[model samples]
Structure formats: C-alpha cells, structure tokens
Target: MENKKEINRRKFIKVLGAGATVSTAALYGCAPGNHSSSTDNPALGEVPIDKMTYRVNPTTGDRVSILGYGCMRWPLQAAPDGKGEVIDQDAVNELVDYAIAHGVNYFDTSPVYVQGFSERATGIALKRHPRDKFFIATKMSNFQNYTRENSIEMYRQSFKDLQVDYLDYYLLHSVGGGSGIKTFHERYIDNGVLDFLLKEREAGRIRNLGWSFHGAVDVFDYLLALDVKWDFVQIQLNYVDWKHASGNNVNADYLYGELAKRDIPAVIMEPLLGGRLSRLNDHLVGRLKQRRPENSVASWAFRFAGSYPGVLTVLSGMTYMEHLQDNIRTYSPLQPLTDEEKDFLEETAQLMLKYPTIPCNDCKYCMPCPYGLDIPAILLHYNRCVNEGNVPKSRQDENYQRARRAFLVGYDRSVPRLRQASHCTGCNQCNPHCPQGIDIPKDLHRIDQFVEQLKQDTL
Candidate 1:
C-alpha cells in the first residue's frame, strides 16, 4: 500500500507522458479531465507556439530557436525498485516532442550533466523525431583526463551516446574556471585536442566549434585571440552578471561586447542567474510586476538576453511542463526591452547588491553531503527569508521580534534539524562542484553563525 504522496508522484509521471497540452495545463492548475484547450485558464491564454523567435548562425546558416533547450536538469523520480533516483524518460520524450512541435529546434546537453546520463537520455528522446528537424549540441566535457587518447575516446563516445552521425554544435566545457590559463592550455592546446576538434569541424563531423566560459578573463581573451575562427561561444549572460558578476571580475556586457566586436555568435547561458533573477525580492518584484503585469519575472531575464544582436540562442533548463510552457510564451514573440526598461533593470540590480544573498541556484550538484547538511534547502530558506523581509538587520529594529520569529520558524520548517547549516563541519568538498563558483564552506559557516545569533537574539 503506497502512501498518498507516493501515489501522486507516480500519477504525475504518467500524466507527463500521456500528452503535452493536457499535462502542462493540469500542472498549471487547469482541470485535468478537460483537455480540450488551454484557453480555459485565463492565465495560460494562448502561447504563440508557431511564432517562436529565431536567430541565424552567420557561419553555418542554421536558424536556431532563441529559446534553446538545456538538457542538464531533467525531471527525476524514484526508480521502480525504490533504490535510487532516475530520470523520468517518458516525461523527457513528451517535453521534447512538445518543444519541437512548438518551434524549438535546438537542444544542448553534455557528458557530465544529470549524473552523466543527460546525453543518453537526450539522444533517446530526440531520436524519435526527424533528425533534420532539430540541432544537437554537446561538449567534450573531458575536463579531467587531458591525455590525447582519453580525450579522443571521450569525443567519440559523445557521438555514440547521442545516436547522431554529426553534431550540429560542440563546445569545450567549462573553460577558464578551475586551473586558469595554464591548465586550459595543457588540456586543449598542448594535448592537441583543439587541433583535433578543428579538424573534425573541417571534416564536417562537427558543424560548429566553440567553448563555454566560466572565469579568468585572460583565458577568454586567449581563446578569442587564436587564429582559429570560433563559430559560436557560450557565456553566462543576465542582468545581474551584466554589471555585478558574483565571483568573476569579468561581466557579461564585456563578454558580449567582445564577441560582437569579433562578429562571433554568442550563445547565452544562465540567463536567469541560476534562478536567482526569477526569485526576486518583494520590492524588486513589485517594480517589475508594475510594468508587465501579465509577464513572469523569469520572462524579463529571457527578453534581456535575447535583446542582444550577437546572441544566437538563450539556453534554459526546463524540468517541468509548466516551465517549458512559460518559456515558450516568453520567446514566441520576444518583446525586446526598451532603453528605459533596461535602465530600470540595471537600477534593480544595483539595489539587489545591497542585500547579501548567496548565489546558489539549487542545482543540487553538490548533494549527499558527508555531514548530512541540506545545502540547497538552507540557502533557499535564507534567500526566501531575505526576499520576504523576514531577515532582521538588528535586535533593535522595530520588526525584529516578528521577523526573528518568522525566520526561525520558517528555517526549522524548511530544513530538518539534523540537516541544518549548523551541522556543517567546513569540509569544503562541495566547493569544487558548484557551477556558480560559490564558496560553500565559507557560506555555510557564516550562515551557521547567523542562525546561532538569531537563536540567542544577540545580533
């Protein structure tokens, strides 16, 4: 006898596989039985599915969907054996079908995404459709094994796993982040991997070649300065990173500007700053909502990313049907931001810097903590409290008593006592895994001290 929660989880997975419109409508609070039309709910009026905006790759003449699908965060459910987690393949297939029918033609995945199963799952889903209908983008992702043989083997494995004869787009995964310029050179330049990839492109096995950047401006400049013509480049671009990049000194504005100057098509990632831009403070939310009352907060980020002339595509990791629908509507007929609107968002970014919130995207890459701390939940609760005005600055503030009570109550309710931040031992094992470059141990320690002070009412 399964519990109600377990039964509902299974039911949801089934619903996702049955049909796209029905599943998405049900997920968004519409009646499940009435699968006739989406217009039943005024909220989901009618997405211009056939009117999706597109941009062309100047080098290859590929008309890519501006809203490219990122296959990193697929929906997950407990395996039938109830032993471990597994991607819900049926749901993935339905989502892929729905996306393609609605005008999306690009999908991005990597060897290491989704516990190393993303590429295979993506291939399985996309293979059911016409091969010429959608473009496949994947990466070498051999960040560790720099040996030429290992690199070549990894590259070949991607094609086999993807079930594709030739990749439409390929990237050097996470360039410039870990070991800086020297490691980058040792991985690609010294090892002859770059030369091999260039040859693959020349041979038509790889249609386009580029790299996804993370840190170290010198490395970015170094790659761009090469004689090799890069067909496209991916960078983290959002209103927040445009001006206030968290850990990296380089900003998206500079990155985009550099690419634009070089006539290189820029592929945008982290347009929502790993969901931070979507979940904004009440004050900022009010500011945005007041203008576009019908739009979601996430749509603003998408529009901003698409406004650039150099952008070839903006990648979003949509795990749920509702996310897919919302993004589809946003990009169907993208409303480019006006200069005034851009200024307003820039001002909002400046104001957001005043409050210190950890830039954790809840990606869950760093999980199963050795110390049993729920890192994402801790950071989420803290950020939520900050957004809702439940974080009191001092004990003397007028709302300190109420805010303190709310924060403490919410923190405990959100995260179990055994998995709270106070249990962190500063192991620092999670630091290297975070894509956002967050200082995990330092943040956990600081948060633990803050929680202790809240308990003692000393701060």
Candidate 2:
C-alpha cells in the first residue's frame, strides 16, 4: 500500500486541508485551485453581484440575502509549529470579499465552529468592509459548563471576537441535544442566560433572537410555545430530510411548518445533508443530471430549501471558490421549484434513504477526539465510498480487488495515520455532541472491524 497510487488515491478530496469540507467536492474528482492565497480564481468573478435573492425579516424589516454564509467550515492550513491546524485568514478574506461583492450579506458563525476560530477569522475578514455590508450572527454555544457566569461570559466574548457592537442575529445554538427538555432548561432557562439574551435583544444589542433545533419535535414545539417572540429560527432543511428526518432530528417539513405557522422567518441549515446529497450514487446522479443537465446535484437541495416563502436565508458552509461560485449561480435571482419538481425531489429523497451512509454533518461538535481519531473524516470517507459503489461486501464480489483497495487506500489517503478509525478508543466523549444522535463508538468500532476484514482478505 506504500506506493504512489496509494498516496495520491484521494488527491482531489482535500481543499487547503479543510478536513471540514474537503470531501464535499470529491464526487467531481477535481482538485480545487489555490484558494489559500489572495490570487483570484476566475470562477469567483462569475458570482453575480446583483442577481442574489433577498428575503425580508418581517419583524425588523431587514432585507437579508437568501444565500447566507455558514462560517462553520472555514478554510484551514497546518499551523506554523505543525502541532495542529489553524484558520486560513487570507483565504477567508478572499471568500468574504467575493461573497459580499456577490450580494451575500447574512454571515452566521458560532463560538463552537472551527474549534472557536470561526468568529475571529470572520470578524477579521469582515472588518475591512463597512459594518452595514454584512449582517453577522453567532450563537450562545454553552453546550458545556452552562452555569450563569460561564454562559454569560461565552455570550459577551462573542461580541468581542466578532468586533461588532451589536449582533444582528443571536441564537440559543443547537438545542435539545441531551436529555431533551432537561438539557434545554439547564443550558439556557435555569441559568438565566436566556433572560440575559432576551434583555440584550430588547436593548438592540441582539437584533434577532432564535434557536437552531437538532433534536426531538416536542422540544421544537416547546420552544415555539414559549412566551418569547422568536425573530427567526434555524433548522436543518433539505429535500431528503424534509419528510424523512433521521436520528434525533425533526423533519424539515414539520419544523418549517411550525415556524411558518408562527409567522417566524426561518434560517435554513444542512441543505447538502452534510454533502451526502451531492455525492449520491451513480444511478441517482444520472437521474438528477437527466432532469437538469446543467445544474449540479447540490443545487437541487438549495433550490428545495429556498423555494419556501418562509425561509429568510439558506446557509452554505462554503470552503472554496468553486463551492461559493456554484451556490451563487444556483441562487442568483432564485428559481423556486415547481410542484412537479418538488415531487421529483421527494421521490429522489425516498430513493436516497436506501443508502446506508452515516449521518455525520461534519459539524465537528464531536471533535478533538481525546484519542486522536478524526471522526467526521472516517465517517465521510466511508460515506463517499458507499456513494461511489466502492465498498465491496466480500472477497467473492467481482470488484473486490478494486473496491477493497479503494476503501483501504482512500481511507489512508484521506485520513492521517494517527487519526484513522483504528485509533478510536470507544471513550464515548463524542456521542452527546453529535446532533444526528449517532452512536459514535459503535459506528467507529464497526468501521474498524470492516477495515480489518478487508485487510486480511488478500485474495
């Protein structure tokens, strides 16, 4: 396996070492241009500065761009000391420059994204531009140590890092994770942090206050029933997850319906289903291509999310110029999906349910595995092979040699040796953080066993 072929097996997967979204473009099998430097990629020029769709917030009357920027997966590079990774500030500036120029004004970040580097980098990039050029959003990500002091500190620090006097949008970040309502109360209500945020909103410091939901429907309804008037709410909405929500997540149809019922503007997330929809199986890809030959498979999801009148903006965590360019093209003067097209995507979603891919969104909430395993990379690589039809079942399979080598070699190439699935220690620290409610340890163990089996069958 120590050959040139093995080393370069996944050369096209990683972009600027953004383990976050590197494989997002793997289906195209084309290595991206240098997005690390300030150098321009002509594709960036194609992003329309005027054609972007805009939606109004009924409460504030703020006209937000429909194509919002999710700052969770910023471009990354190896740090100077080579000990760990760091956000690529120059790349972020370029990405921000093109996004603002292309009429993208809604930028969302969180205290938890990019290992707490997202807000700082986003602030640095946007600082050069006029403050009115963008509407910045961040979260009260008091997932742990949600004591009143800690949670309040986390909230205040966001202002400092974002370099903003007032946050345009502030969230109660990814509620309903552990113990559902119990966790919600402890994280926000019991600690008085929710009251503090609500007060800030009244003082004009937080223009819009909302929460991003990721768990039980009861919690979603519970939050909606609260006396507080939510300005906007974020939920994972894509064609596949609209009706057939997996894991602890609520279906997008229900989530959106409830938000619309309350007349609340919605901020959409996970339009790509963690890149699974884009890297669909060959037959599915062909089906989509047959319908819209010029459109990217990923565009269908964006169209689905943006088609709804209730959606204020659809967020895409773009890490490269091409991803940004492709999204801008899709949303430029937005084309709402017709009834027939919506039905087609629903059928496509039903077909996608059959594939056995793990639902890791690469949110990296379950990151910094104590034992050094790269959880998202391991799961995503497995997902890619599954989509590509490269995960062979047994040695007797006709494509055994090709598939086996593809799995083994691609796994090694995409994930560093120390960070491979074999390193997972089943410590279970990553379980509660997973918004999809994946049994991280069990899945890692199963994947490790599969890899070991593949290695032993040398035939």
Candidate 3:
C-alpha cells in the first residue's frame, strides 16, 4: 500500500516550490527591461520575467504555483466548435501551452464550468503534454443534480474527462452550497462514497482529499475536524470578502484564522473578488500604482492574498492571454506586500465600505433567480454605474434601452425581460440566498426608485 503521509508530503513539496518561483518571477515584468535593478549589459541581461510564484506546503514541502490556471472561464465557441458544442478547443490549447511553458502547473476546473465542457477541454488541451508537466485539480460538483447516482456519475466522469487515472487534488465542491454538505455525506460519503474516494486515494487515484468551502465557519470547522486528514481546502479569499464570510454573514478573518490554527493549506478562489478588486477606484488604484507602478492593478489583489502565510494557491479566471501573462508575472518570484502596503489596502477597503456597494462577489450562488431577474448581472451593472458616477445615465440610457431593445426587437437573442428592480415585489426570496447578507429587496427598491425618477425627468 502507498503511504498517504509520504504522498501528501511529496505533493506539497512539488506544488509549493513550483508556486514560489512563479510568484517571484511575476513581480517584475517578463522582460527585465524597465524594472531591472542593475544596468550591466542591457542586451545580455534581457531575460523574460517568470510568471508564477510558488509556496511551500509545510506538511509535505511540495512547491505549488502561486497562480493556478482557472478553467471555469475558458473561451467558448458559439456552436460546432468541439464535442460538447462549446469551448474553443484551439484557444484552450494555446492558453494551456502558454501557462505551462510559463511555469503554471496547477490547473483548477470543475464538472459544472462552461456547462460541463471545461474538464473535457482541459483534458484535450493537456493530454498532448507530459502528465508530470502540470497538476490537475477538479471537484465533486454534487450540488445541483443532488442524487446519489448523479453524484457518483459526475465524480466518475471527472477522471474520464480529465483523462487522468489519478488527480493531484480532488475536492468536495462548495461545502457551503446550502445544507448540501450533509446531503452529500448522507448520499455519498456516509454511504461509503468517501470510502470509495479514499480507496481510490490508497490506489493513488486521488493525491489529495479536501474541499472548497462557501458556507458557515461551523461547517468549515466540521470538515477541517474530520478524523481523515485533509491535504488542502479551497476558499473564496479576496480583499472585499477578507472581512466577510461566504454565506454566514460572519467575518472571513475568523474562518481563515481557524484554518491557520489547524494548519490546513488554503487554496484561494476569487482573490480578485470576481475581478472587482482588479478594477478598483482611482484613489486606490493610484495608491497601488505608487507602490508598484510597473505592476497591473490586479497584481495587488493577488499579492494581498499571497501576503498571508497559510495560502496554498491563489486562483484567477484568466480568460485572455494578456490576463494570463500579467498574472504569471505577478506570481513569479512572488513579492509579498509590505506592512505599509497592507495598511493602504485596508484603508481603501474602509473607503469602499462607505459607498453602499453591494458585497456580492458574483459567485452566482443565488443564480437562476425565480423571477427571471439577472440578480448578479444587474448588481454588477448597478455597481459599475455607481462606481462610474453614471447611475442616472446607466439606468435610463443603458438598462432601460437594453430592456426596450430586448422587448421590442429580437427577444430570443436578448436577455428575456421580466421584473426589473422596479418590478420587484419585495418577495425577498433572494435575501437568504445571498452570502453577503445584503438587503436585496431594499436595495432593488432604491435603485428602482432612482431609475423611475430618471425616467420621469426625461418624460
């Protein structure tokens, strides 16, 4: 039998080391032109900056990339592109090739991403390369189709789709996806699903056993306290949510601190707060630029998440090549933020709090709104308008015009019309579903009233 301890230790060493280098190289631009400290021979010293940072897992001392390639946002084709009728395979291949060549070894994906095409796309893209060149991580997405058979099928399909007999990291997806964890355990784990997974691990099918969480601290603690040793756990960690928990209306600081106490390696999701932190206000952006003018705004978010010690990897949904390259540079030779920089970000966080900005990370946790309202999408547009100080113009000119076009023009192509925030009856069904504890209906009313005023003014 293979030694579980040794397997985990080896994995940690590999992941942590690979990740550390990536982080360090990314700090300076790939081409050491402007940011190079010494002015020796410019031509001789022209070296491309590495695009990943590595962290050492204390348990096994494996080096992992600071920047993990997230497959959830892979480019998709309209139709007739690949097997699943989605996901541009050629683009995926290019991105994966670039990422791997640049030192990003960890590729994070799930069964549900891109309507289930992500895993297949990942497998197809990576199959040509040496298996050892990269590490693959996927999850047990037993939430939506919550059935024993369905769950089992999904788990089984992940390996097949990933084209890997063994997974470097396997996670119980979204442990905080409602009382779904209990359902998962009862349906799968308690009924020997965990046993099956563990058996596979014993057979070297799963290199690591952990979960990505999005719920209460109690739930997080429950999973962490399990007698079976977990190799790593993924969490939504970003500047905005640093002070907030996933769904429990609690601060994330407590949750992360608990993990730190237990010595669990934390894989971070949404380090950029679903790309919100990347595009910050002018004041904060200016401050960040002052600290590191060469680095992109997104680098600060990644650096802030990496500034903490317990973090194993910070994952980003890099859809474009430029985004991927920028991130790689950020993580390569990872530059941990100084205390002064951290303080500045904290101050910016407070300033952001002053604006009645909805704390939605747009994780789409409360997706498929019963009333046909694009809750997250609307919130995003609203936030953008507010941030840009064009709420009146946005509501009247943008959303209203779009709605009019949708209703008047081709309804099939456009987003289906239903209740705008103005039409919200305040049924308040979405309130509890939100992890951010936002007053959903109340805010909808406020926005709706403002939009109404705008319409009336033009009338």
> Against the hidden reference, what TM-scores do the models get?
0.86, 0.91, 0.78
- Least lDDT summed over 10 consecutive residues: which range in candidate 1? 21-30
**How many residue pairs clash per model?**
0, 0, 45
Candidate 2 per-residue lDDT, tens place, 1-459, comes to: 334422332241222233443333232221122112111121233557789999999999999999999998888877676644578899999999999999999999997777667899999999999998999999999876778998988888998999999999999999989999999999999888889988999999999999999999889889999999999999999998999888898889999998899899999999989877777887888898899877777888889999999999999999878989988998998899999999999999999888898998878778656666778878887877777777899777888888888778777766777778888888788898899989999999999999999999887
Report the error of model 2 at residue 378, Å. 0.8
Indicate which candidate wins on lDDT: 2
Please estimate how well model 1 matches the true structure, expressed as its whole-model Cα lDDT. Answer: 0.80
Winner on lDDT (2 vs 3): 2
What TM-score number comes out for model 1?
0.86
Judge candidate 2 against the unseen true structure and give its global Cα lDDT, from 0 to 1. 0.83
Query: What residue pairs are clashing in model 1?
Result: none
Q: Candidate 1's residue-wise lDDT over 1-459, tens digit each?
A: 235533543453343321211112112111112222221111254767699999989998999999999998887766676645578899999999999999999999998676567899999999999899999999988755688998999899999889999999999988886778888888898999999999999999999999998877998999999899999999999998998887743799999999999999999999987676776776787787898878787888889999998999999998878778888998888889999989988998998888788887665556546666768778867776676677888977888987887777777766678878888988786776576788888888887888888899744
lDDT (CA) for every model shown?
0.80, 0.83, 0.66
Sort every candidate by TM-score, greatest first. Answer: 2, 1, 3
Please give the lDDT score at residue 325 for candidate 2. 91
Stretch of 10 with least lDDT, candidate 2: 34-43
Q: Against the true structure, whose TM-score is highest?
A: 2
